[model samples]
Target chain A: MPSDSTIQVRQVDRYRWLVPKQGPMRVDGLVFADRRLMADVRGDQALQQVVNVATLPGIVGHSIAMPDIHWGYGFPIGGVAAFDPDEGGVVSPGGVGYDINCGVRLLRSDLVVGDIRPKLRELMNQIMRDVPAGVGVGQRDLRLGPQDLLGVLEKGARWAVEHGFGVPADLDRIESGGALSGADTAAVSPRALERGRKQLGTVGSGNHFVEVGYVDEVYDEHAAHVMGLDLDTVTVFIHSGSRGLGHQVCTDFIDVMLRATAKYGIDLPDKQLACAPLDSDEGKLYLGAMNAAANFAFANRQVMMHGVREAIERVLGRSWTKLGLDLVYDVAHNNAKWEEHQVDGRRRKLCVHRKGATRAFPPGNAELPAAYAEIGQPVLIPGDMGRYSFVLAGTERASQETFASTCHGAGRQMSRTQAKKSVRRDGRDLRREFEEMGIEVRAASFATVAEEIPEAYKDVADVVDVVHQAGIGRKVVRLRPLGVLKG
Target chain B: MEDPLGPGVREVEHTADVGIVVEASDFEQLLHRAAVGVFALMYGKADADLGPTDLFNPLGTRVHLGASDDQGNQAGMPRPITVVGSDPAAILLKWLRELLFLHETEGLAYRRATFDVVDEERVSATVWMGPEPTPAACEFKGVTYHDLDVTPGVDGWRARVILDV
Candidate 1:
């Protein structure tokens, strides 16, 4: 929850609420939540953050929050907003968050639950060994030189593909083809570069993981069939980001933006909301650096995905190709991108920021792959490890109403300490608990597992229901974990 | 001089991340205490308190000593670090950033700190580095400036900062 809360909200309908424009807000705040979710939200200051975001200069529409909204640093988690650069729209690093491009990728396989049920433990162990995880762990064997690092910053997942990590075909399934243009390596600092050097293919600690699961249910058979998600088919979910590099990029730019905010005479509700006019040099430089960092994240996940395929190959004694492992979709939940969206019946180029949210571009959007053009983008929503995750599709209503975005995941409802304390109080052993459910578990720290107990987040089904019912997101499939690896 | 207000660090609650509340008699003490607390969050306090084996190190094992250095493994040389920022909060954030970088790169945890210079814009300190930490329970991505607070009170100085865990 936020440190402060004094905003008032009125219910707009069963699944939405409105925080009317007041104070310095340029627009009203719109939040999609049921009463139960709103009750949880009202306890936190997330509503105030919605208001805070609405106060930013050049905000095009109502500051928005999804049902999964939770308290976050500057803008609330699950927040989405777009700004018009022509109207003094400013870019704020805080909106993109510290882990730039922190995202998830789903890979579908031909293997069924029966094929890997017995060897799930071995498969998980192999992946854990192949992928370096935990705090302060880095890829000792894959350190990148300056030039190689530059390539990663420039080409993103393409660099990984060229370096023999994965096939070229995998790129098409990724958001922005796994690399955003306009990346300026010159804008990335030496510190940021050094931090990212050894972390290229490693998963850093904290809410990051590689989960092996299977499709337990399919809600929209056509959408699922188009995405190759069939009932009982196995899958791999990789959730990670650019590691230290992204953090340092955000850290470095927050300072730059702070000064720019003062220089541009932009008044902010909070210092952390520091920003610069989109056309300014500072803004452009940050965009370049942020894009580079984001590319690194795209490449990071790509490399890790390859490692998982190799791990599966080693465990099952079959080539990944024979196993029919294919990229399903990769979506970044934290990022800001320039896109053209219709506003008031006119196409206006806008910079949309999705923090703790996912882009759910409607069907027929040109950005989607041809195979998915008729089904819309596949929105990967990973729930808590113990429960289930949902796969949703973008909708026309989403593009028209929310600038094409939806809830990212099951947002946290408990603080780390609170979660840990509850676990201790119950004398629960998370590993054993998960094992009892027939799920194989491996982690760098049991403390992390305890902190991320299933109850730590709201039931993702509840959150997804709101978006689905609101017509912003269309449900496609649901996945249940067979084995999990936590960083 | 014995301080009237005890210097210490306490974990504070946040919905998604971790935070620390640090209290010290002065700015330099505040930074030192906060560093210890942050490391404690990642690595447990078991190492922070030197064991009897740590006191009698026949192998001359390198040890990182804290502000109260009375025990354990061979004392290592102090490393000098200088950081400049626009304000005290910025300085604290930068200091923490450097410490985190050292932890990620050199595996050095905070042991002790001696301030040679201090001000809102610049801070120079000679810090004792510890050996590689044990497997961390958690990893902090970076320190966040969200709702960051550094204030002087009648009792002493207090700072509250959040970590992107």
Candidate 2:
């Protein structure tokens, strides 16, 4: 048997590469990338993470890496793996990531590019004023009382609608209907609650954004129309998560899982992949708290969407309803959920961990909302601020091969320090560069804007093409930014 | 403000997040340097670029958490800080995480620390605090254990830690 040091990657097809299982790995590692993208994948330590994930207990099928994969703590950013509990499967906090339920929410509006171009700056400024952002910025106006906070933990997005943060119909368009079941508030710690109290609706720090854009192209007209997309139609994308609550949840549980890992004799290739049996007391407690954190995230996006609506209303002198601002869908990229999938021609219950990946349930999947049941789940992929973002649909091939998951975003190519240093050396005015492209930019700091320069990431178009060509996801529409608010 | 490259702390690059590699004369100094490195990442080391201050000062507005007096002593009242873990690496991770939490909730940026007791499994210190500045180059979500290490070498001590942003 070849040792992990000698692990070899063989090309399976134009868009697929396979790392045959060896060493302690229980399954193969499959990566979706074209030659050009594959070169970048091999440049980082992400491939090692994929191999490490395959060594986890009870992992089913292949440990997959999407085209946008990049080096991340514990697991590669675009890694997806599912574990079978009946086969001594384990649940890991690292698999879900520090930001539990970190995800994207898309909102479609009736206004077109022509309607918003005149007041784009005003709209962006209003959004910047309305939403609390940047490092350690918490909501001043929307502090949740203890009981209300508990309701949010228990009800997720429904709590926001019930509290008048949004409309009731918004729940229908969210993954897991905006709330996962079995969230126990008791499982959450006091420290986690304290950290999240004032941060419910704030867009906390790095890479989180609220972007205003217009649909520039529609590849699948039928699917586009179903999701309220049309040429030049204005849209808003909110990328955020459960904030400190989620981070603290993952932090609190990692320590528990570490101790449990020793208790259960679960050997791990990395300390960050620390885990316990799915049925263990430690595992159940973590799931309960994680679900609570996920709920906090769902409510967070809902609250922010409401803020965006109010910002638009203030700018346009029309109610959000009159502007036809509606939530298209919300998808959580960082999560672990119990799912049923066919394994070796037999249906088995599995816990799927998607870190920096999106769930791509195919057409006819019972989990999809009725509006999208015929098309497939709307997979929201947000690119960097300057470039274009894509809307993709789930495919059957993905369900069979990857536990129905797809890429999350345009992964980073340069380190944050490198991006900053390059920007300084080139003397590029990021604000002017963005404005030159006709995109209005409002940021919490110039340093953030510099670190997040467009060149810092891979062209998302290339990543999306790989997913489309590989039949894991299908292209629907492409959106180009008009304005962005970053923290 | 102390130099970001003050021989004890240096920034390490990560694809998606940020980290620091720290070295010092001993474990206590290693812990102090790590805190400085992390706070410097959140609030740039230069006094001119401390950026905008947050609205609330839950720590009651010390005015110079990241600043030092003419005599080279850090400001703010020194408070007790104690943390425990399985090993030195774990202890460091927990210490960094504790400082991160304090920075977020109470706006306490690290000033300095006087180690009372420090070992592989535990650390107790009298930590000086300060208010956190906003509009930082970035924000870190949490400290992670991935690839974390803390070790003693002939040249003193060394540690590496990655933070999730």
Candidate 3:
């Protein structure tokens, strides 16, 4: 057979390319990136993955990549696709990623930017110190027993809220109400259970972070107002996910599916996309385990919010309730879910795979919370600690088109190693750089600090603009970083 | 003899979808071979033989990747793989993982790879998606890198890659 090198590349526009369908590919691969980004992206193997995903069984629409697309296992990061279960479509871990429901949440404060700038360092510092970080550093040394853990897997942040991690209103702003049902702890391994026992309230390392910021700019006045954003308003952002426990769950099942492939007799272009029929016992087991981890992530973030509230109270010497540290919204980035969408003009249920992407359900969708349904789902996109983040609302355009998914954040512009090397050469102290930017910074490790320097990522503003212009999601508020806690 | 360090990528089959491990002297080389191996199973070829004139030899591998199960809802379990290797290291690991995944999912198999060095983190290879290597068995769902250990060798370069499967 002709080698993969025989694969052809066709530029479709200034920011998109086509990996033509040849060989076993079922559809063409589409990449979204400016010429500048594409040059670097093309040099990576992610394009091949995009092409490879097209060959999967029953993948509908385009196997698409966001501008932040980067090389990843099985499926490329920032990739999206939909599959039909009736057609033998398969869900691949490589498609959703390891951080089950790892995502971003934006909190809008009633306070203005100027009011907090002078106290930015203290605010950021308090949040950073209070939130548990690093790998497996438990919250107040809290541990979950089987019963408590199972309850959490089912109720998610609701459990945390009931226990005082947050209030009832917080659920109104959460995607899937902070709990994705169908979490079967039985699918989980003891190892995964052990690792997650104390980690539910902690932030895991690599790309996970919490930041404090102020609204810098607003593009769509109506949309921004609908999103509860005003110029210079203070906001807080949390980006993290299910930690080691989730990783173990995935590890627990990769083996199970390997056998399923043989039973189902499906052909695979990439092994990382291992799977069984959706109705198989193996599939059900994996789904249960994955959901449990997802619930864990939601609960973890909720407790961290509580810790942030406590820290705020400690620093400001006032109650968070009085200060008004309320959640604006939370959205998962890398995940897979069952949803109803228009397929060939019919409301068909399908498995939507959004890896490094967020669901931007348009306004009027019944799924959104009462308050936000009028504005649509809140899409929280976080930028690098040194850059700015944005709040957006889903659009009908997105729902009718790309399965209500949009790009997650500023895609990587430079490799972490390359960023490190360049910083080393330029004598840039990652810790000091954020300080100079007037953004408080804390980290679990200096290496990670150095590796995630703001320069390492593409200008997130550009990424948010793409989706906004494309009408997938409309801009709401602009969050400029004040401080960051990294892991 | 059984490979004590779990199964090396070499043990990965096209259709078994089994996860395998790959090691290299350095991060860059490890990623290089891993990428090679992932793609190797898809196009079906031994990427080792296609270096020099083929693969683009970029300088690095930097990206965050996650894998998930196919079931919708909470069933969509994702696993992350963090690797950095040059052509040889990346190609092998990449090919093997891809083969292992295919084996677990589709029950396909192919023996070799043809690698084209695109850069340090990127490689292009053709894999021969052969017929099923094993019949009436399980499929590999995904691969994950957790508490992954990659230590530099005495040669001052080393890597440890673990697949969740």
Candidate 4:
């Protein structure tokens, strides 16, 4: 196994390192990290995956990695790569990950920290009951028939809004207006459809959660204000994805892409990177299916948000609307989208894949909603439940360097087995530990909490600092979790 | 029945997700042990126990066994489980994916599995769908081909797999 000392890296700047393009690589690899984080990154196989990605046909700029980069299947988590369709660039299922459009949503409320402190336990219990969580646990009330499921695939979050889960205005605050265009229901498989039928409005286990927090500090006052964030104001964060539907979609497409890879004669360094040309029949089908899955994910989070609103209202004895519980913004961390970026001084159309990275579009980008045109896109980075999360704003430097991408989260620092072993060896009571910190945590099982211990992840503040220093994203506000509900 | 391969599995360290290493005296035993390892990882050893069952009615009358022609409706059926692949590696991948799908969609936890036919190209197994178990510690999204290997070693047949959680 290659170690930190074995990997070759040339320092590009204080925050950027270049893995010089060599061997079969078509482009250089760029990783953004400071000295301390770079040491951790080099200790894993993530940089090697970056090099493998560079070997893919039609790669643009550099195979990029955010500071939070870690070992993943084909592309490292926190890896971003763009491909030119006209140049035989392809889309790989591994690049988008299994949980299609797995993303985060933030909801800001009028209530201050003082108002929710005393009722935090009640509110957490309310959310735990209202939201179906854990593996295979679905909302019995939200089950969809075949036809209704098709509507979700086609309309994404709009389906939830039309179903009266939320108002149509919520759609505008979401990326791609809560639905990706060109989603073809017919392209989705029966298994995928079946898996999605009863799984809507669920938070599946492992790192996914519904967190209640407060804005503890504001780094960029103007941007924070634009995002409806105020110091000491309570907020809600939903972290989940399309559930079984998306996993089935990715599984189905991997078989398709494997065949496509052979037909296109594309040699692969890793089978997980199986792909086909973007314009090929196989590629187009995968894209359509993937988009449909992405839509389902959008609707899943939207529905869950509705449930959260209901829970909050029931607990507070006030209507959600009356409390000003409105969505601030929603962004997908796992997806591939057709975007235009400047390359070699020429504007080119490319398909950008962000596996475990978030889109950080600069202010003035036409894609920004009118309200955020001056403040840039709102980026929510949720840290471990015990510590604090951050809100960031997209920067012009990100657009110029990394196809407008930034780190997703703190990223896992320890394996699940390692975490469990540590907990058992030390005989630590994870729940009591969190309670000691004054954070209430309700989970399906204590084992889940042990695996998700704050020690298992890097300090998100450090991750955020690297991106902020690299100028990919600018820090806006810091959020401290008061209560958390996990599956 | 005398065992041809010793039964044992261990969790391997993976940076992001869960990884397991399974070993047996032959390929068939390796597959069985891998399934055991997966269930153990999801729910722990106490809940991973398997009950004895007849092959013809492995899941009993509780599960409906019928073939669905429509692709979307396939996950609705719980039996007559037949999986085909081009090679041993593909077969392993398909088998693991099927187990994950069943666990995620049907709420079926397998306590025992009996393979009627096992080869490089096809596998037919009757998995006894036991009572729904407690919530798993973690949810495995899917199996990946990343660094997946199934080969014969000096001890027996060995396989390594990574599960996306």
Candidate 5:
């Protein structure tokens, strides 16, 4: 086991590096990045985390990382790992992270940039008022009791729709129809329930936001059309997760996995990588609880989308349907799912864990909605609020080489403390900086704006270019932020 | 005035989240100061003149302060809370998590904290909490064991914690 500084990396292609199998590794590790990005990747402990992921039981192919890889709890952010159940595969709570099914949702509108420009500030103010955000801020209007909360845990987005939060059609565009099946409410702990009761539609804090942007570039006109994205059209992106409930789920299960590791006779390099065999009782319990939490997140985003639609309608003097504010796609970046894939030329059932990675199923995959059958899954990569985000379509190469996963975002280049310190040292007002770029910023506190300055993150265009050039994902459209709301 | 905890907590560099390093001459002081660090990160510093009554009384029945403090002031002290874990590391983890839970659920922010018991497994502490003056800059989701370490060297006991923000 070499340190990050001494680790050996062999560049296999223009955008991929192979960390060959060594001591105690069941398979090799693969990192997707070009030379420039790889330098930053090598400078951190993320590569070591990649190596650590390879030692897990029943790992297949390679422990893969997207270009946005960064040091995280156990598996590196933007990491993807899969295991075959028939081969003693295991499930790890740390691999899915604390915020289960933390994801992004994009909404497209018929209105163009011209229509939104004059009303951007008013719209942002309306959204900030409608959407509950910041630390421990619960939705004032949508508190749930135990029984209704149970329905949310069980039905996911369906519950929100049934409660008049969203339309039934909205679920069609969401991942897994906006709900993961097999969610057992019994698996959810009382403490998690208490934490979740008031947080259903809230955005919480740190990196989560609601951004109003415009599609500025379309690289693939056909795919862009399929996704309802046109050049200069208005769009909204919602980034959030299950909040306190999901955190409690992960905390509860990490303790279970810690005990399960010794019982299952598994060895781990990091305690955060605690796991249990997929067939074991502990694994089954975690999967049940995790699915419930993921469902909570799905419903969370669904409800937030409803609030966004209302805000737009209230500000623009039109109904959401008249505004064409339809859901483009909702995709989870942090999750574990059971899916069938071709492994060793044989169809096998495996549990795929994508920590900070998006599912980018290619065209014609069974899981995709009929509308997206010919164009592939829509992959939304939101960058810093002041810069740009991206819309990409999945490629066959992604399905074959990376377990249908791609980068989640630009990835952080600096620590929060470092970003804040640099802002103070340079005497820069981040809000003014964004304003200079014609971007409107609204946040609960000044510290958040400083810590999330564009410089704190890598250029998202560079990250998308790597995946596009590597044939994992094809560029479809690019979005530039006009108004941003931070928790 | 000199600080009792003595230069205890400092921020550590992390790419995606917040990290902190806490040091003290003894384990009990380490635990007490770590509480201070977590609260400070969550709600900033408390005013020096604010007492426990000024903090905890607002929460009413939600808070239970067990006994009087060193000054024989019942209003200025919080009830003792005890937690048991497998080891010192686990005990520290539990202690921090309990505080986070209180903050998220009850919106309580501690003005001061003290540890009465500190061994390998069991811990008892008292915290004087008040309503947060403002929202936190960011929310810490949970504490992770990623590269977590608690060690005692010649100078004092030290611990590194990575928080999921």
Candidate 6:
């Protein structure tokens, strides 16, 4: 039910939409989209998903949708909803999504952009070989036992660092020191555990990729300098997530949420938004499993980052340590956390749900690592293989309105089916076109290649511009792709 | 229907092999003739002689045939379910998704399936679920419509799909 249809929307800015609460909705809904981005959502169900999320119990402020809004299983891909535990808020698998903690990480190096321009082929080849690509890809030489896998899940990048994947201090640049607390290996399912055993370092198929980029522009000189990046420095961005283990954790919880939705007397518009009170058993269980998977994703990226470092070392015949290959930052797009945000003139812990959106905490927030306290959290945004990626910093306005969340990536403008059909009709040979564009492409199947065609997505620059202009996230450095390896 | 694929379907990129796509003049032929393709994909075998069981809809939308058997694997006695749908897209998607779902949830995997279809929009075909695939059987990750089409061609109706390895 639309809850009496009294929920009103008022344009707060060119890029933001407000949903005012009237009926059963506890809080209003906020959507970030400019006139250009808003056009894509006109006939889409994602907007309806935003409205549907407003009816959940204990929702705080407004149900927020980021700029890259697309219809997903439950919440819109670029959606953020905060639930208050004091009022019996809930956690839903639809909120966290199948690929739990499916996130992106950025790696910066001291190498100038011009240094590796000629050797792009060799670099892509070496990275592809070092970091195995495609479905169920694993390092045959590095299988782990149950204890080892659990340790990886619990320790995140620390596990990779312990195994000589990278130096010890790389942890300072990662989110949650590369491992979010409260990850219990025992809460993880055996199938999830087994599937993740060999997938620690592999970049799984579909939308996942490893891209080598060059700093194209510097928007914030001080922030870039603090982050050890200069205009024209080479960087590597790893975009992947917790793989199969995360998928199962979500599947396991959807069953619980489905029943919880009905038992708790919550009337919902979509089954995908099935949720239970945050204090309930199902909620706790899903949170535990989701955090475990999120930790797995963190560890997964750490392992891949280590692999990238190794490949760079092998290609250049020098130690990555000697090259100052420091990690920039990593952030998860799909997650719900207990965070203290002021609502109704009081501060309370709300379960913030950022599905396909990243938290954009402003500067001086205690969560920031000691180094980034002055500049705020490092926000990494990756675009299509054919376009440019961005590095942004959080702003105070993000705290006031959005509870510190921003768009995830270039939103999909077309369905997968439409993408495949369109790319094929354009007479564009994806592999050849990618090669001509100086990008190496690999996939388990040809269909995934077509679905991932660049034309299928909106220009990420447009999406990032809305956030940057909106003062939610500010651009720091822009990075353009030199080569990309897709799943 | 005429396709340029080879006669035998064994393996592709990695493990988890053995499946085929069939063509037809219309929806009827698409479902009716797909059984032949299913048998061909499953090492040219079938459950044609198996008795009728039941037709059920798990998702409450599509047609599904759930047939089971209490057979003793090396471990002990276990049961398996086979589901079939009329729409080739629906059937193939359901078959693959169900197989993966069972593996993830119920710890069950299917090595082979005997699929039969009915052409009508409301009528899905039949499926005889078989034992979980052994280590030797290839697992198909997913089916994709990269260059997929079901339009009438020079010969009949055809489609192209890439199976995720």
TM-score leader:
2
What ranking of all candidate models by DockQ puts the best one first?
2, 5, 1, 4, 6, 3
- For model 4 chain A, where is the 10-residue window of minimal lDDT? A1-10
**What RMSD value applies to candidate 1?**
5.2
Cα deviation at A472, candidate 6, in Å, is 0.5
Clashing pairs in 2: none
Model 6 superposed RMSD (Cα): 10.5
Q: Give lDDT tens digits, candidate 1, residues A239-323.
A: 9998989999998999999999999999998887889999999999999999999999999999999999999999999999999
Off by over 4 Å in 4: A1-4, B1-6, B46-78
Q: After superposition, how far is residue B69 of candidate 4 from its true place, in Å?
A: 24
Clashing pairs in 1: B66-B111
Report, for candidate 1, the interface RMSD: 8.5
| Recovery fraction of native interface contacts for candidate 3 | 0.01
Q: List, for all models, the DockQ compared with the true complex.
A: 0.30, 0.35, 0.03, 0.29, 0.31, 0.05
Query: If you assessed candidate 3 against the hidden native complex, which CAPRI class would it receive?
Result: incorrect
Residue runs of model 3 more than 4 Å from their true location after superposition: A1-6, A9-18, B1-165
| Top DockQ model | 2
The residue-by-residue lDDT of candidate 3 on A250-296, one tens digit each, is 65576577568778897866656777766678877787788888888
What TM-score does candidate 6 reach? 0.79
Report the lDDT tens digits of candidate 6 across residue range A225-310: 98877899989999888876787677567667878888989887666677899999878888888888888888889889988998
Which of 3 and 6 is the better model by lDDT?
Answer: 6
Instruction: Compute the lDDT of residue B119 as modeled in candidate 4.
Output: 84
The residue pairs that clash in candidate 6, if any, are: A28-A62, B16-B138, B16-B139, B17-B138, B111-B133, B117-B125
Residue A269, candidate 1: alpha-carbon lDDT? 84
* TM-score per model (chain B): 0.76, 0.77, 0.38, 0.73, 0.72, 0.39
Residue A328 of model 1, lDDT score: 95
Query: Compared with the true structure, what per-residue lDDT tens digits does model 4 show for residues A1-487?
Result: 3454655789999999999887899999999999988888988788889999999988999999999899999899999999999788999998999999999999999999999989988888788878877766777577798888999999999999999989998998999999999897888898998788888888888999999999999998888888889899899999999888999999999999999999999999999999999999988999999999999999999999999999999999999999999999999999999999999999999999999999999999898899999989999899998999999999999999999999999998888767777877787766567779888887766667777889899999999999998899999999999998876
Candidate 6 residue runs with Cα over 4 Å from true position? A1-9, A22-24, B1-98, B101-165
Segments of candidate 1 deviating more than 4 angstroms: A1-5, B1-7, B46-77
TM-score of each: 0.94, 0.95, 0.76, 0.94, 0.94, 0.79
Give the true-structure RMSD of model 5. Answer: 5.2
